[model samples]
Target: FRGRRGDTVKILWADADGLCLFTKRLEEGQFIWPAVRDGKVSITRSQLAMLLDKLDWRQPKTSSRNSLTML
Candidate 1:
């Protein structure tokens, strides 16, 4: 995943007999990221898919209105 400033992320995994590396970058826009904290965060499969598509995984739909109203 790339940060807001275009920082790229590299993922490494070990297979049966060797290691593999994968990377992805968006030509435009940034991946939706969780709040910065001490530990790691978890995301659902659908969220991951949305992220890969360069969409905001945090929100289900971009045009949806906020349910909360200001008093």
Candidate 2:
């Protein structure tokens, strides 16, 4: 992740047709990050939403809706 606040980066991937890019940026704060295990980070859907919103994902105000995980 970018160290500086408001620094944006694009993720590039290739699909069946062609290359695709997705970009996400935080206007004010750093994204809430999850602990990495075995060089990978896994978080719940709710955590992702909170992270995207620049909120603290470690302790959510509401309970998690699903036990499923995301990377």
Backbone clashes per model, in order?
0, 0
Best by TM-score: 1
lDDT at 24, model 2: 83
Whole-model Cα lDDT per candidate?
0.66, 0.65
Residue 9 C-alpha lDDT in model 1: 45
Clashing pairs in 2: none
Off by more than 4 A, model 2? 1-20, 62-71
Deviating ranges (above 4 Å) for candidate 1: 1-4, 13-18, 62-71
TM-score of 2: 0.53
1-63, model 2: which lDDT tens digit per residue?
333453453445598999987778756556656666897666777776676677787776755
**Tens-digit lDDT track of model 1 for 1-71:** 34447534455669899988878776666667656556665667887677667777777785547566678
